[model samples]
Target: MHDPATLELLRAGKLEILGRIVEASNATLLCSVELDGVTGHCVYKPVQGERPLWDFPDGTLAGREVASYLVSAASGWGVVPPTVLRDGPFGSGMVQLWIDTPAASISDDEDSGAGSGSAAGSGSAAHREHVEQVSDLVELCPPGAVPQGWMPILRAQDYSGEMVVLAHADHPGLRRMAVLDVVLNNADRKGGHVLAGLDGGVYGVDHGICLHSEPKLRTVLWGWAGEPIGDEAVEMLSKLASLLEGELADQLDEHLTIAEVQALRTRVRRLLATRVMPEPSGMRPAIPWPAF
Candidate 1:
C-alpha cells in the first residue's frame, strides 16, 4: 500500500480534504470522493512527522495508518479497516472504508495537575494518593514495554469510576485497547484514538508506528493502576495469547518481522500471569499532554 504514484494523484486531486483534523503526529480528515462513479467517504491521513521524526520504512503518513489498520483488523481489534491501494498516475494510492460516527478522545486537561508542575510540589496526603495512583497505573501496563504507552490518555472527567465508562472508570475497551497497544507496541494511541460512536460503540483509531518489538507503550489512562487484573481482563489476555499462534501472526507477517511476532508472543506470555501489571520503563514517565 506504500505506492508513490497513486499517492501523488490523490494528493493532487485533494480528494475530500474537508473536516480535516490535525493530530500531533498525523492529519486526519473526513474525505469524500467518486471512484469510478461510486461515491464514498474515507479518512485520509497524510503523514506529518513533526515529532519523533517519522522513521518507519515507507512513504507518507498514510501508509503507516494503513499498516496499523491492517494489524488491528488482523488481530480482531476492529480498528480502521485497510482498503486496497492500486496503480495510479503518481503511484499506488490507498482506499479505505470510511466509518462515520461520534468519536471522543482521551487526553489531559490544560487547567491543572500533573503536566502543570503541581504534581511535584503537592505534599498533601491526597496528592500522595494521586501520585500512588499514577505509579500504580504505570505498573498496570503489560510487561512488553511500549515507550509511548506510558502516558495517561484519560482524565478524571473522562471516566465514571463505577463501571469503566466515560467520565467514570476504565471500560473493558480501554483495557482491550491497552492490550492492543502493548501487543502492537503502539506509541500514538491518545484520547482521540478511542472514539465513541453515536450508537455507543467505542472505536480506536491511528495505529501507524506500531508493530515494534520494543517498549513503546504510552497512553493517558492511569486510573486503573494497582487494580487487580479482573476476570474480564484475564479472559481478554487469554484470547490474545491464543491469537498469537494463529491468524494474528499471518496478518502481522505482511508488515512485521518474525522477530516482531515472537516479541508479541513474549508479551502475551508475560502479561498472561494474573495479578502482575507492566512495570514502568522506557517512556512511562511522560504524562499525556494532549498533543492532538
Candidate 2:
C-alpha cells in the first residue's frame, strides 16, 4: 500500500504509534510503525542520528531490508512486505507489517547452540526463545535434522508462543527461498522472520542485508550445506536466471547490481555441483564476544 498522504502522516509521526516495540539489532531508533493497507501493526525501524551502526549509515538497515524484500520477491520468493521508505522527520526509514508468530525453534533437534542463518549477530533472547517455541508449533521429521545454518523458519522479530516446526526441509518452495536467503546473505532470519500466512504460505521478513557479492551467506539453514543440489533446484535456478532480464530483473536492478545477480547464480552453481560445504572465512573461528 503506497499512499502519499498516508506516508506523509507517518513521516510527521502524526499517525499515532501504538506501543513501544523492542529496538532492533541494527537500527538505533525506537521502532514502531503504522500499518496503513499492508496488514497488521507494523514495526518501523528508523535510522539514528549522525553515527548510527558501524556497518552502514543511519536508516541503512531498514532501507537495506526493504531492498532485500524487493529482490526476494523478484526471485519469486515470499518475503515480508516493505510498504514504504520515506525521508521525513525519521530521515530514511522503512515500514513493514508486523506479524504475530511465537518465538519457537523450527529445528528438530535440541537447541544445541545458536543458529547459523542468523544475520547481523545472534545473541538476542528473542532468537533463542524463537527456536525454543517453534519446537511445538510445527511437526518435525523423525529421520531428518536441519543443519545449523539452514533453519526452516526465518523470523524478523521474537515472540513468546508455540513454534511451528517443519517436516524436514521437504517443501521444495520453502527450501528454494531458503537458498535465496543464503545467496543473498540474509542475516536476520530470526524465527519471527518466517511468517505463516493465511493460506498456509510462509513469508520471509527482515532482509536489510541482501543482494551482496560478498560471501556473507550466514543462516541457520545449513542442513543442505553438505548435500548435493537436486535437479529440481537446478531447474528453479535456471528459471531465475532466465528471468534476470525480465520483470524480476527490473525490480532487482534498482537495488542490486548485475554482478550481484551473477554472484547469486554462482552460489546456485556451487550448491548444484557437489557436496562441498561453504566454510566461513571469519577472522575468529567461532562467534566472537558480544554475541551472547
In terms of lDDT, which candidate is strongest?
A: 1
User: Which residue segments of model 1 deviate by more than 4 Å?
Assistant: 1-19, 27-29, 33-39, 46-64, 74-168, 282-284
What lDDT would each prediction earn against the true structure? 0.49, 0.47
Off by over 4 Å in 2: 1-15, 27-39, 49-59, 82-84, 87-89, 102-174, 196-199, 257-262, 268-292
* TM-scores, one per candidate: 0.58, 0.57
Model 1: lowest-lDDT 10 consecutive positions: 110-119
Q: What TM-score does candidate 1 get on C-alpha atoms?
A: 0.58
User: How well is each residue in 1-292 modelled by candidate 2, as lDDT tens digits?
Assistant: 2334434434443223444445345443323333443212345666553235444434456556666665555555555453456653455666654433333222212111111112112446775554443332222322245443334432222244434333224444445556667556665444334554322345666676565676665554444555555665566566666666577656665556677767766775665564244544554222111111
Which candidate wins on TM-score? 1
| TM-score of candidate 2 relative to the true fold | 0.57
Superposed on all Cα atoms, model 2 deviates from the true structure by an RMSD in Å of: 11.4
* 236: Cα error in model 2, Å: 2.8
In candidate 1, what are the lDDT values of residues 1-292, reduced to their tens digit? 1133333333343355446555434445555544333333445544332134444555533444555665555556564544444332233444454433322221223112211122223356764454333322222222234334344333333223432221213555566566566556666666655554322334566666666676666655444544565665566667767876888678666656687778878876776764455544654643334423
State the number of backbone clashes in model 1. Answer: 42
